[model samples]
Target: MKLALILNVIDPKIGGVMIMGDRGTGKSTTIRAIADLLPKIEVVEDDVFNSHISDYELMGESIKEKIDKGQNINSILIKVPMIDLPLGATEDRVCGTIDIEKALTEGIKTFEPGLLAKANRGILYVDEVNLLDDHLVDILLDSAASGWNTVEREGISIRHPARFVLVGSGNPEEGELRPQLLDRFGMHAEIRTVKQPSLRVQIVEQRSKFDSNPYECLNEFEAEQEKLKRSIIEAQSILSNVSIDYDLRVKISEVCGELDVDGLRGDIVTNRAAKAFAAYNSKDQVEISDIKQVIALCLRHRLRKDPLETIDSGFKVKKVFENIFGSS
Candidate 1:
């Protein structure tokens, strides 16, 4: 819920939450629930790219048809495409290549879209992100940053808007993500296995009940999910009006500078996230408490490593905020 709220505030269009944690911590379960809880997005029919919002890239022939006939464009609400980037996927499969079947049968240079295109305007999930090939990882990072995909290999030179929230999950113990890729994640969270026996038992029982009677279980949670979704929609509506005072902005910059966080992205994302939180709570402006709650998620992964000892990064971040801006 916190991650979703943050995303809605930060970058409702392309912001994403990358979850890092150990296995069996309900990472995938939580992602699926969030996807289910979101309102449906409309898309063009049978377009794997979910290309409906813009018509800039449509084929010349189709564009002419729509222009000449003056046909009313129809939009259909489908489940937001939550595409999973599987491990062991090849570059050809991910960024797409020429259509082998088309070339052999029709003798044409038809460009086939890949997973990235299919994930446009939606969430692209990469489980075991740390294990992804370096080349594939580069492609993902480039697409996420630029919001566009250009494939020049295999006699194809197609460019399409490939904007989407990139969500990745991995156990940090297994492998580490490259610093370049790490910076692309707007918010990061670590989930741990529930230690309390009763809580663990409750989780298992809930899963069993969900599996046994999926429909009934979903029905029971449907009202709660709907209320949550309404909250998100309401938050989005008010996000534009939320104010960030100049004093708070200076404090945000100072804290990031104090922590030695690289670049200005941290400052920008932090300010935007705080305003989003304020809007979520129907406040006219952000408060110090909002910054404190948001700074941990924004700056935790951006801090420079200290060799002397282990650091409680979250606590350290909160402490910095408290010292600079006073506790909320």
Candidate 2:
């Protein structure tokens, strides 16, 4: 679907982007393509936490083993961490718990890492995120915000970095996300089915070709995908140098104030999104246009409720932006 370009702009390494759309809009496919295009990362063999060069989630025993043996820890090539959270997961499964198998076999209480641990320094995808259990949503929101997972239950206490770009997709026909949880997402986009007959036919043909010979189709696009991978790596290096100037800050704060967004998070995300836009355009300094492009993504879900009408927050934000920045 060539969605890699849009995804590269909102990739986890650049912070995360949350997508809301209909079922057949290629959201999942876009995620898979992004995973395929990203560079492989080195991880510990057989480690559930996907331990990397500086993984702090390693158990004390594993650390001791590495130290005592005086053997260089080996690196295994694995796909960049992309963990999907199924809709029917329990709290223990999502946040980790005491390993029952280890306790039963060795009569010891060893902590077992869960999905959050596995998602370190990678992407976490949740389909139908709007319908996820409230408590589980709370856990995800907390980790997404704090960049750490802390567990205290059954006399087990541990805290490890669980930082990851949270990617979520859902059908708007179902229900909207809770305002509190919605604020945690850094960027938001709404996807819809391609309505044009020509585009619909193109989508079907592409899927048919892919299904018949997946490897062949992938090989055909491999070169283009590799080019994108190099671009993303370069973008990451350049993003740190992008500047958010004083005028840009004033403009950002003014937009939030005009919109009456609840808290400081709106401004924070807006700033980050503007910086990301600057990086995407290969510019060192953010421009007014950058702010215009990202304000909707950063603040769409944070607006006050209006049950009388359905407003696309992106459109509303764009209107406000044009009013302030002048149509360009």
Candidate 3:
């Protein structure tokens, strides 16, 4: 799950990660901790949407207008937004609402930005996402894909930049997202509660240390955090230069085809993920080891459900991968 999250941070275009694990597995804690690993982003000064200074597609309407008018745009570094999407949130809360009264009285559309706006160019995390309304889930996925959110009230329509890495976490026991919806996520990571007694004890000890001396604990990890932050920033800089072999690409697609995965999403994600993984490792060329590492994460949830099959989806993907590309 940590690897998947880091990869998404390196390239939000890899889409977002869906994490499924047992309750009390530190899903939320880990997701929040990743924010610390992220480097600060550049945004237009005083922009509510965290609009980029130069990327027009990522800028809000007001910022775009200012740029068009040859206005001096100021930028500042800020932490990437990490938004928690509550289960009971209404559509208006997730997508900004238009003030109908103002629209009618003043003949102007007054738009109030919502969570999506706040999450632009950052992370939007949904806990127990399977329990969220399907329509809201659709809206989130659509905005994540298109990088824009459109809210129409009466005859007034307002759209804004809504690019964000959409991360969702849930326990399989509660419920599961519809297969179609699950497939839309770029990667899926499954984690389990620690089974080793020593590991469990160490986890408890770590938690106790943090709770008792939060400052000390943070200071202890500060160097490590900065190192990881530097690595992520460097990876992002060289991601486009990372290349995957054509044979590997064909083999990745072949694995997807053999697994009966729907659509070309699995193939595309695997390719992108492999490239990201390579870049993360500071390698310019993708190796079979890289593909082997991320193939299952990218394709596991995309496989067709077979009720009678007892094998794990990830294991099935690896088995197919080994057959096609030979054992790593």
- Can you write out model 1's per-residue Cα lDDT over 1-328, one digit (the tens) per residue? 3564346424644256668888888788777656665667766665556766446543223433565687666557987677899998998788878776787788876777789888777778898998998788779878887878887854646677687778888898997787767777777777777899999899899989998999999899889878878877777777888899999999999999988889987898788888887877778799888888788888887877676858777678878888889876
lDDT (tens digit, per residue) of candidate 3 on 235-266: 99999999988988999989999999989999
TM-score of each: 0.88, 0.88, 0.98
Off by over 4 Å in 3: none
Give the C-alpha lDDT of model 3. Answer: 0.93
Scanning candidate 3 in windows of ten residues, the lowest lDDT window is: 32-41
lDDT of 2 by residue, 171-271 (tens): 88988788878777767778878889998998899899999999999899889878877766766668878888887698778777888889888898788
For model 1, give the RMSD to the true fold. Answer: 3.0
Residue 69's lDDT within candidate 2 is: 71
Better of 1 and 3 by lDDT: 3
TM-score of candidate 3 to 2 decimals: 0.98
